[model samples]
Target: MTETHAWKAEDFAQVNAPHVKTALTALQLTGDALEQGGAFAEIGCGTGEVARFVAERGFEVWASDASQSMVEATGKLCDGLPVTAEVCPAEQLEFPEGRFGVIHSSWVLHWVTEIDEPLRRMARGLRPGGYIVLQWTGAHPRSEGPGMFGILRDIAGSPKWKDLLAEAQPGSYEYPAEEVAKVLEEAGLELVHYEPDLPHPFSAKKTMADLPEMRERYKLAGFATQAAALGDRGDEFVDEVLTAMIRAGKTDPHHARIVARRPAA
Candidate 1:
């Protein structure tokens, strides 16, 4: 599955505010741990929402994403702000060593096939005493066990989707907070704060109430990648999955947040 095409820029832009809000909260929690006015970078900066928030706070922001449309959208959204947007994949990230004091990524790292290299690069990109803030979906709601993807795996059953899910087992990773902290520690970062589970930023009841529109948005944003994995049958597959999710009253997946710091020299 082409990572870039999995999410449409316009569709993602619509539901981006809540995520930006969460990332902003994480940034605020970092507080004085980050050097004031220091360089900041966001990986997978879809639509530039978080970058805009950071730039508006007077930080020089650099953001990158695999999707060109997202990069372009970010550029336009951040126009006139202290921000730069580039088209780059996580594995290809190339930042100067010890260049940034704050690095942020939201709902992005799991997409990368390999986490170690990019993580090592992120660690290297931070200046001593820098802060690295990350957020990603940790696990699916037990209530929705197998949820939408379960239907896909059973019906469509494409090898690509299977492999993608198989790599991490299930569509999304639910890394334990301790494991994530250990990964950071191995990369020479000290854990400052960790939230293993955060409340879903959106309301499931409201989403279910507006099931049709929500399904459309999900088709464009969340299921696009899955659709791409399904090829010609993608649309039908997504429709069925969304219908199932609505019927099952599945809530949004839980998220994990981590704030770690590179030790002072």
Candidate 2:
């Protein structure tokens, strides 16, 4: 798999604001948290919009991401904005125990195959009663039927590719709030709130909140590499997938948000 993405620091301009809105809505952040001394951290803070939003709300913000491009972009976006940007992956954070009043993540935890370890690490970093707000893709099919990956597999005549994706963990664990709460409780986090029905479009015409972050995700999910391998038929393959998504998004929507908190000791 190609670890580095062909993306620019400025390309994230499309995604920052919408994600900031989503994070703020999910966090239910109040003006009270805007007071001085409130500390907040965002994992996978691309381009630093969310960090700036929290910082503006009066919380000291720490933004981090694994991608150097993302980290650099975030630093530039948050420059002179009372925010700290760093290159840190969710699994390993360099911070003292119980340092943050709020821990927020946007469309990040899912990329982590080992979800539990990161949650444990986050728990260790959160102050008691601090909230962890997350907006992520849930278990849902991209298309009405077999999905784009399935179509690509058929076109390329490869059973292995189909099997790999079919076996891939569905977009998410697809558990309800109580189920998520159980996981959090076991990890020493108290269940505060979880809602898995936030509907967002996979693709949209404008770059406004109408579009979910799936535009970049689909390409990054090895689709671009596979398309390149498909040779001359790549253009047709992408068109077919996009046509299907346009049709599906008209009738079905797929997106969600989940929030939990570390208990006060």
Candidate 3:
């Protein structure tokens, strides 16, 4: 079974909405892509924000997530729209061959136990010349000085948190842009575009005034992973990490976007 993340669906939706919107805009999916679709699927439709966005554009959407709460939340969010919410994981997605004209995933692929099989399934599920857009953490920034997650990760790896790290689930998988494109091509999709860095509106600039806002955002932005690694002391750990980041003026993490197409029949 896929392990449930330590996040509530509502909390995730509230925290990730802006980032999701930014990703959709970066892919330029707000216009014609929605209008021309046969069917659209969001692989990890947390709270269904992106699904609803596509459905609002008049596209039929199948939104799936491993978490039942998330699926239910998606269903509630997408009510009255042409959308179906299912509790499905990336590895076990059950779509008929060539069922989708467009498939979209945001920050979800790295959770798969094995990447290739899911990519293959997605490739087969796309209709001829269909598009698949994905956004994921390509690489985390690690510099000589302390930064955001890097500091958190270092703290987690320390002897004080050794027991917690041993019990925590593995961290998300990240790959370079070239490797990502190669994987897509090997899965039988033509790589249309691959961007290693996709910009977001969030400012990395740290100010004493923004600390509270940053703390809240961190809680929602996969900091749960680090929190899990710190066990009951997670909050305290994050507080220190954020303080360190602010002191060092660390920026937000970078994300990658890939757009690929299945070959025409």
TM-score of every model?
A: 0.79, 0.69, 0.81
Pull out the clashing pairs in model 2: 34-57
Stretches of candidate 1 exceeding 4 Å from the true structure: 1-3, 33-35, 139-174, 202-213, 227-235, 243-252
Worst 10 residues of 1 by lDDT: 164-173
- lDDT by residue (138-235, candidate 3, tens digit) is 34433333334455666566777656667664455555556667778987888777677766666446676777777777666567656755657777
List ranges where model 2 is wrong by over 4 Å: 1-7, 29-31, 34-36, 139-180, 201-237, 243-253
The lDDT values for all models are 0.73, 0.59, 0.72
For model 2, residues 91-148, the per-residue Cα lDDT tens digits are: 6675568998888887666445456667777777778777777766433432335433
Per lDDT, the best of the predicted structures is 1
Span of 10 residues, lowest total lDDT, candidate 2 = 167-176
Q: Per-prediction RMSD in angstroms?
A: 4.5, 6.0, 3.5
Q: How accurate is candidate 1 locally (lDDT)?
A: 0.73
Predicted model with the maximum TM-score? 3
On residues 8-46, what C-alpha lDDT tens digit does candidate 1 reach at each position? Answer: 688787777787888878887677843387699999899
